[model samples]
Target chain A: MIAALRARNPIKPGKLRLGIGDDCAILRPNAGDELAITTDFSLENVHFRRDWHSPEAIGHRCLARGLSDLAAVGAKPMAAFLSLALPKELTARHRGKPAWVERFFDGLLALAAKMNVPLAGGDTAESPAHKGKAGLVAADIVLVGGVKRGRALLRSGAKPGDLLYVTGPGLGGAGAELLALERNPSRFTALKVAAPGHPHLYPEPRIAAGLRLRKRGLATAAIDLSDGLSTDLHHLCGESGLAAEIDATVVPIHPMAQLAEAAGWARSALQLALHGGEDYELLFTARPQTKIPRELDGVAIHAIGRMSKMRNGKPAVTLLEEGKAVSELRARGWEHFRGSSSD
Target chain B: MIAALRARNPIKPGKLRLGIGDDCAILRPNAGDELAITTDFSLENVHFRRDWHSPEAIGHRCLARGLSDLAAVGAKPMAAFLSLALPKELTARHRGKPAWVERFFDGLLALAAKMNVPLAGGDTAESPAHKGKAGLVAADIVLVGGVKRGRALLRSGAKPGDLLYVTGPGLGGAGAELLALERNPSRFTALKVAAPGHPHLYPEPRIAAGLRLRKRGLATAAIDLSDGLSTDLHHLCGESGLAAEIDATVVPIHPMAQLAEAAGWARSALQLALHGGEDYELLFTARPQTKIPRELDGVAIHAIGRMSKMRNGKPAVTLLEEGKAVSELRARGWEHFRGSSSD
Candidate 1:
């Protein structure tokens, strides 16, 4: 399997000194630059169920999670290291051919090629699942990215009057997740409007926009909208020691939001927009005087909120209906230990 | 637990722009330098059985595996990212306080501090083991190190006349295993001579030794002794397109080797030295006139073999006793899929 992965993803020239067949992958980050490193784990039954999610979806989702983290730091990915733990069923050579593993790499590498990042080095191991029990297939990806020295955007730089913005569509992950709960994954591949679109199956990281925001000196603070709007906004605020007031009506809901509500998985588009996780969009803050554009690379950038002073030292997110604070966005996001029941 | 670890090991200045409390840990490798990255998976029941190993021991072993990889490439440690998949039993807050989890971090952080490597960014998730099943506590560690440009050692560089050497005592891991199988956990701590010594409990990486070899332009090729002498030698030979002849009598046998044989675990010192795994020592080949030192930092450097031309296009390693080939070393080392049953 390791040989097959290396064969599928050949190293690009001048970037990697040594590739897969070595004790370690040797890489040269651009001179005088900093490397942004992030690691994420996509675990079975917690992140996805194999019977419901296709191998392609699992692979794509794992890389997307790590890339989104790099995007939050406003760095350009150079290479990735994946450590995968395979379940026993996948290794049963006597039973049948394991095509799922190949397909999983296909989906993962396809995304990597599109993003121009090489899958350099990794480790593969067997999960400790006894007979008659379902084992967890976990993929832990470490993404190495490069950014200008001392210029990587941080989560703790937002000021009181800074404007907040997010890139890409909203609630796509939540919409697909609703259809997944219905337990008919084939619908995701067969039906177009009734299910989630390509946005959910293959969410692209806002790398270009993030780099632009960093290089142009536009974003004061940045974070990926991985843990839903309310929870992530609270995180940014908590780090910056401030609070935010989001205009509820201005939030853009996913096009499949109506379908999710009609299927009784979501109460409303507004609710989904507020608390839906895995959006993989960039939520950033910019100076109030910065002349921000409406979109970058044809993706809409909505102005949803503004940073404010701390509100009574409680939770840091405030949802404003019209000009008054209607409620406090006290909702939580994905918790790996507690299981992402809300997502 | 994450906060505790961050407090325990703070990032050193100038090397890092940001640490722990961010989307990603930001680091700056010196200009004109290359980065060596390696990842390893330490899984429950595959790498170590929980009933037989303490949390601290497991933690130390996992990080040691990754550091050994870096040491093989002669790269100085920079930072590490760890993704831990904890079982439900450990995460259950009501289960009499999760001391094992804390102890695990304690063990891991202690090694990181001693090695001067910062614990940067990581993700923690719940393992998918249900009640009554043994949960797998797997840790995937990615270590990033810096090396001079175009100077990282390669396994394929060994020539016919190069001499091979290994650092540290022999069969430490195998000796420890023999004691562990005897089911007396306290013996390893109390009766040091009766069991494997500090070499087993805390296998140190020969980072400084590797750096010295690289700086002095001594080593031609290098590999870590993770998979025993026989298996790892095969790897070096296969990469270099050469064969090897190892003198079994000259191999440095650990003092506790007798304890392993007396306990009916190993047949002889020669056998254990040939096939013992988890030594975490550097096995490198140097030019014949390199004037290599016999010892480094109180560790013996044993020259047990030399590279040779391919023998019959097969049998990459020939075990010789008293200057005559006695047998071909063909026994396999630990395999994750096969559950490391032989070890």
Candidate 2:
């Protein structure tokens, strides 16, 4: 199996002195660069449902989760390591091919190639089952990225008056698509190619935008919107020891989210945009005087809020509603401990 | 939970620029050094049984697996990123404390401190359970280490006539202890502290010996004895495109293996030494004329084999028995796909 994976993903010899087949992969980083490392888990049911998601989507999302972290830190990806555990049935060869596993790699390696990252090395093992119960598939992806020394963006670097920005045209497409998937799993079974509409299955990581933000020194603080915007905004504010006020009227809502609201699949598009997780977009803060671009590398950038000082007896985040009403924006995001159902 | 883990394992801040509570951790590698990366999985039932292994031991073994890989490449430990998925019951508070998870970290952080590796960053999620079946605990540990550029030990660097050596007093102690564990698990429930005798539960990684070998330029090729002597030796020879001959009588058998043999726990100490896996010792090769020391630091080194040219249609590895009987040595290590039982 390791040989098959290596054969399919032939790494060019440059940064990687040694690839798979050894106990460890050796990486030679560029001079004067700091390495950014992150790991993420994509477990069965919790992260994806086998019946609702294709093998390719699961693999793509697994790698995307790690790459998004690197983007959050404003680092260029160098290599990715995946440790995968699968049940017996998934490894069995049918018609002389391990179709499911191969398809999973197809999704993963395709993204890796597109992002110019190599699948350096990792471990593979059989998932364990208890008694007559079936085993779940779990994948953990580790990404190693590089940035100029002392130039990586962090969640704690924002100031009280920094303006807030987010990448992409809008948000909550992933959550809306997930709602559609739950209503009809078969609607996405034939969706083999990764396109813009399938954000829930193929959310793209904002690597280019993050790089530009860091290289040009346009952002003060940044974080990937993996857990809803409200939750992640809270994290950024708490880390920076500040507060935030978001203009609800200016929040960019995805067209799909609007469609979901019109179809009665969601209570409101604004609510989904605020609390829908897995968008893989970059939410950042910049100095109020900085002339930030309207778009970066073809991805639209929207300014929707500003950081603020934390006041006694006040919420960390305040929502400025369209009618000038105010409300505390609690983090009703997709927390794993809150429930077992998928978000 | 992230804050608790960070507070418990405070990094002294040298190689690591940032620890937990970020999208990614930043690492500053020393000048003229390359990074070595490795990942390993510890799955419930497959790698450890909850009834037989303590939470601390499980965590120790999980980190030890990745550290041993770093040791194989003669890399100094830098940081460890762990992605853990736990069952609901394991995460729930017991008597106002999350004892199991805390003990797991206690075991892991204790070794990380001893080895000078920081718990830099990681991800945690709830392990998914199917239907009414209980969920399993799975951990994937990623270790990043630094080595001098162009000086890493590799499995493909061995040459014909190179002498084979292994670290520590003996082999098969882990395998032998596993046998005892299978027969009477309750006897080891109170064995909490890490010591030399418990090879299976608290097997030490030979990082010092590997570093010494690389610093002295004594080793030509290297690999960790993770999959047993016969299996790992086969890997070394296969990668080097060479064959090997072992002297059976000179093979170092652990005292625990001898005890297991006396207690009828294993067929023979030699058999256990030959094919039993998970020793976490370094198996390396040195030039025949190199003045390799008898011991590195406190770990003993023994030379019991020599690399040889591969003959057409001949076995990759040959075992010379006690009376000079030569026989083919096949890999009988613990393969995950072979069966559902433990080693």
Error of 2 at A313 (Å): 1.2
Listed models, DockQ each = 0.56, 0.57
Q: Can you tell me the DockQ of model 1?
A: 0.56
For each prediction, how big is the interface RMSD?
3.9, 3.9
| lDDT at position A5, candidate 2 | 81
Q: After superposition, how far is residue B54 of candidate 2 from its true place, in Å?
A: 0.7
lDDT of 1 at B290: 84
lDDT of 1 at A46: 73
Candidate 1: list runs displaced more than 4 Å.
A92-98, A131-134, A172-176, A179-183, A189-196, A311-315, A334-343, B91-98, B131-134, B172-179, B186-196, B335-343
Give per-residue CA lDDT, model 1, range A1-343, as digits (tens): 7776778888769677787878999999898789999988888777776766677777887898889888888899999988888875675544465566776786788788878999999888776665556557878888989999989999999999999998876654554454555457665542211122555566778888888888888899999887788888887888899988898878888876666777776677677778777788899999999988888776678889899888676557888888788988875664432353211
lDDT of 2 by residue, B247-303 (tens): 998999999999999998888999889888899999999999998899999999999
TM-score for chain B of all predictions: 0.90, 0.96
lDDT of 2 by residue, A76-165 (tens): 999999999888788777988657788888889989989999999888878877777878899999999999999999999999899999
